[model samples]
Target: MLPQHADPIVAIATAPGRGAVGIVRVSGKGLAPFVRALIGREPRPREATYGPWRAADGQAIDHGLSLWFPAPHSYTGEDVLELQGHGGPVVLQLLLARCLEVAQTALPGLRLARAGEFTERAFLNDKLDLAQAEAVADLIDASTEAAARSAARSLAGAFSQRVHALRDALIHLRMLVEATLDFPEEEIDFLQKADAEGQLQRLRSALAQLQAEARQGALLRDGLQVVIAGQPNAGKSSLLNALAGAELAIVTPIAGTTRDVVQQTIQIEGVPLHVTDTAGLRDSPEVDEVERIGIERAWQRIHGADAVLFLHDLTRWREPRYRVGDANILRGLPEGVPVLHVWNKVDQAGDELPRGDSDIVLSAKHGTGLDALRQRLLQLAGWQSGSEGLFMARERHLRALARVGEHLEQAQGLLTRAADQLDLLAEELRLAQHALGEITGEFTADDLLGVIFSRFCIGK
Candidate 1:
């Protein structure tokens, strides 16, 4: 824990701008003096008291409800006070300034809270683990309803509970292994008698299940990045508008209307999809400098995309030059990235909507076969239908779980090699336990905490 956690902190807890109400919050050890200084008396604990918040000269600053939460019973495990008043930006600023002024004499060393400092204090005070602290920010920044629900579950300790359970199992297994090492002289094979192999197998199964849920949670949190790339006038902008249900991109009959990347985020069955519509891909010496830059940016986005929706203009599918251009663009795409072939402009081609297991056929202008496209996008994202009880997770959590799995696999391999290599097995188990501990912050560094909490908004 840092020494800064000991100082009293204050901030405008409500968001910026005018609203129905605003809150100025202060948290520290022994806030009773500050409370009396502001409200003229110590308010009842855990109860709201109607009072006039006064300045240093006893002039009324604002009339509001004051709530005082005594130490060990508040959000930060400290004595916390909340002053709720009118939401005007000026009014909130005045209240905040007055609090700081009064604190200069009433409570020395009182300072403004940094971004996410309040939640960080809670973690240092044992109120929340690292994962739960992260989830508080995730919950506030969730873009979709499903994302919000998953973040809420994580904030409620759903993810941390699983990590703790896995860690406990590992501890028990380690105890059994170490005990066997201590009594090697005894015959009867203690490990075999204890069914350590069976225990390890069960642990592996539980880890696999936890990993799958964490992957799903990560998908809900970060969502999929899908980039659209094709030849000019392949209806890329039109497709983006159709998918987003808005004119997020300008569509025109002209081939080069879209000269830059346009982005939109849409949800399919509660799964958020971040779609980027890029400038059409083609080889042309006549192209200007701006179009060339746009095309370069398009390729950059495609390289990073989770999936690329390669659109094909059905009306121009048979042109030899068009075929060459499409083939070249497809070959240039980054390897290992999933590409979904989409045949557009079926209405103009007077073609029946091709049915089968290969590629999506749709007319973005007419909105025909759009449902098929949406489903295909979802399928490409690896989204499982009816995903209930999902918890929000970040990339770091996934990496920690991966490392844990790797350690366990190494232990399993060592166990099969030789009974004399028990030390290696113990080391692997210890590493696995450590990896799991990182997820819940049982093992973590101060630098990591700074990086994690710095992303949160001020006063969180």
Candidate 2:
């Protein structure tokens, strides 16, 4: 059971404001007393009881349906009470307030729910594992259907079980290897004769596959941040409006119309794209205080983007000019992250939409070449067009996986070393196992858990 010895927490589970129904949820030991105080005795488990939730003076606050979930079987592994009533903002607030007052009177130490304390309690009590707890938040905040489904799969332990399976395999190998270490006299010959290297290779292959899948999931969760950069009036802002399907940035024939950076999030075939449009890259006397700040922010965005769409106007695709700016900005963008050499206003340029085989032609105003641009983005993200099997993941998972990769590299080095340091190899293997365990919360710290769940909304 959870720490129901502490006070119960009360919160409105449903969305705030007017609607057909609003639910006020209470969890902990005080649930029964609060329920008894409101509607006489608590109702049957999971059964809807029709009644008027009364105040301390026995006056009806609202006529509603209530359900009681007895201890240990409830969501938080404690007694839970849910009062469903008409969804009026004022009515819901009054209902919540009444429950708090009644709980404080009838049961000592009851208090209002914290931001994500209920879910944290559930996780702490083993009502749900860490992966499932994260899924609760992901499901609530999912902006796309694919994201929601991925989160559901995770909630069902689809992702955790996979990590556990890998951990299990590693444990088996560790047993075999660790046993050899116990008898150092026989280890040299036994390890040399055994297929230890082959086994390590296989483990690495499996880890690589899992790492790839986890990365895909992380992309689905965090999405791609794409920044548009180039000279003045290169259709950078136009591309933003076209992709977002709204006038997110003001476009004009004038060069410096966009003095500040503009951002919009839009889905392209279920892959969320965070597109940013910045002031045209130019030096001008009129570039004032705000515009200068905006330009600095734009540079920051360019530095931290998943992909940079360098909009080189087809009519003016010349050698890299702008002497004051860094030449490496266009020349040495990170290796894997793509920089599309976009030739804009193709219609005006006719059949000659800039030369060279490596350029993409598009007209942001006419909506001519957006599909190809989006496809390029998907490609850079390692996503195949019209592909399936995308999952949802977070940066924490990626960091853990990266640690696994690092350990693998170390293990490989130890294996190939002239001295054949089996101890170092074993230590690397152990490190890799520990890193993998972090993804499923087997080795997570309390503060880390606090940070993760605190990002979630209440009543999750």
Candidate 3:
């Protein structure tokens, strides 16, 4: 029998606040007694029964539908109970209180679940692997339709299957190498005859492809952070509004109109880009205390940004002062962050649409060249559009895959260096398999699991 937690857990599974209906879930081993005490009888497994949810004193709490899923066939591989009732917060609380009250005697030690405990139990019970369990949270937290679809695919085992396939191949290759090491006396070149080198080559190729897909998925999970910075009246706020397609920021011709950072998350071809518009960068004794604070905040955002869109006024580019100001701002930019030099307000510059290899020219006010800018932002994000096989992935997953790749590279190097170094090659292959196993929780640390599951909302 599978190991199971003895204590029962209860929680309001639905989102907080009033809605048409709400669900209260209970999970544990042998919850039939608790169900009987609350509803006054046993519920047929897998069947929803309409009844009055009663208190210990037989007082009716609320009439609703109740579902019972027996152990080994339910989520968490435990006896599960679900109460669907009116979504009034008060009503749900009363029902939840009743369940806890009944559990005090009928199912002692029943308590509220910790964040992600439900899914964590599912993982422990073999209902889902580590990646699939994570996908549950990703699906719930998906910010876009594309993200949601990809998360669904992950929850359905798309990503896990790929990892498993790679792991199986690694295991096969490791077995062959280990066997060769065991038979050092039979120096008949069994590896070459078994095509071990060919197998290693194919595994490397597969890992590279999987790594690319995982990178794209990680980008989807953690969207790009783009900060827009420029001098006052450089159309920074205007570009923010243009990108967001909403008047989210107060756009004014007056310099330093945006004295605080304004943020908007806009989607380009289904990839989310978090854009921040910051206060103008100009030093003057007339700059007020609040504007100075905003300028400081702008620099902070730029330093943390994945990409920076440094807006330059095309109309003022010819001015000596403007050129000097641009150079100073450029000097202050953080090293290693990709920055796009954007020239805005071509209309005011009285110039035809200009294009260059290193800069993008656009009139943010008229929406000219906006599409090109959007496409450029996507490109900088390393996004691959229209990849139907993409699935949601976390940074941890990427790190695991990267480690696997490194181990594989080391193994390949050892194999190519000398055929007699089979022992070293076997060890590297074993390390690679172990690294790949971490992705699916075949091998993982308890502390890492704690960190991963702690971020989930309570009740999963």
Candidate 4:
């Protein structure tokens, strides 16, 4: 533990704004004296007592409730105190100040809690594992119903349970390998009798399934950024509004009406897609300074997007000027980013069809062919429409799982390559175990812990 972890910490537990109620929380060892100084009494443990908060001068500061939790029972496994009162910023500040003032005399080494310090303490105290600790933040930051549900599952140990399952299987396999290496004479027979090859293959199969599910979870947490790009009046804004099912961007027949990016988050099959409608892509002497800036920003966003929806005006596809502008946009799109050729105004295009077989023709004005477009976006994201057992996961989890798979692959090769591979096989298994431990933070570094926790909201 760091020296700072030994000291008591205090902070306003609620958001920094007026609410119906607010909380000022404190946690540390030997917080009894500090509690009595602020509340005038210890009250019952785990119970809320309504009373008046009096100052050192015997003046009433405010009337509210206080709850007490002794060590090994509270959120941080320390003696914790919570002062609940009006949610006004001033009242919360005054209450926070009173705790500090009383701590100066009643308690020593008391200071404000750092962001995520409280939850970090919870993990250190064995109240929650590292995965659950991260889930606490994920649950708060979830933006969609599916994301919130997945995060809630993770907080409930769904992800941790899966990781634990993998770790247990790996440990079992390691034990068998170690036992074989112990008896050099019986090495081959021991492995064969225990079916070591079978275990490795099964483990690899299970890991593949886990990787697919984790990819979905990561996609749920961090959705794809889809940028709508095309010539002016290709109905780029119309496509955005149509996909979002709202008039988020100003749609006018006049070209260059949308002079800025319009972004909106829309969910397809419970997967969030952050769709951005950039200014119409065009380079013309008629373009003004503001439109030029918008066009520049559009390209920047296009380069960063995970996917691009290159919208085309079907009604003017025969025009030489329109075809040239469309060709220019196709050339400008960033390489490696998946591009979906979307043809809008199909209702106005009559029987004329685009040359590309895969081009999606849609009438943004009438909402026709929208279902096909949504399905295509989901396909581009690699989302299985009805995948079961999905949970919230970070990019780090995916990397760790990938590393484990790599080590396992090496171990499997050793099983077949040579009989003298016992020592090498054991080393590979050990590395795989270490990689698995990183997911749940059983083998995490202090600096990584700091980086992870610091992203959390204060007083968490």
Clashes of 4: 0
Query: Residue by residue across 239-357, what tens digits does model 4's lDDT show?
Result: 88888888899989998999999999999878999999999989899999999999999999999999999988888989998899988888888789999999888888878587487
RMSD of each predicted structure: 1.5, 3.2, 1.7, 1.6
TM match of model 2 to true structure = 0.90
Better of 1 and 3 by TM-score: 1
Write out the backbone clash pairs for model 3.
none
The per-residue C-alpha lDDT of model 1 at residue 274 equals 97
lDDT of each: 0.90, 0.78, 0.88, 0.90
Q: TM-score per candidate, in order? A: 0.97, 0.90, 0.97, 0.96
Candidate 3 wrong stretches, greater than 4 Å: 1-5, 352-355
Give the backbone clash total of model 3. 0
Off by over 4 Å in 2: 1-6, 183-195, 286-290, 318-337, 350-356, 412-422
lDDT of 2 by residue, 390-423 (tens): 5567888878888988987787777766144777
Task: Give each model's clash number.
Answer: 0, 1, 0, 0
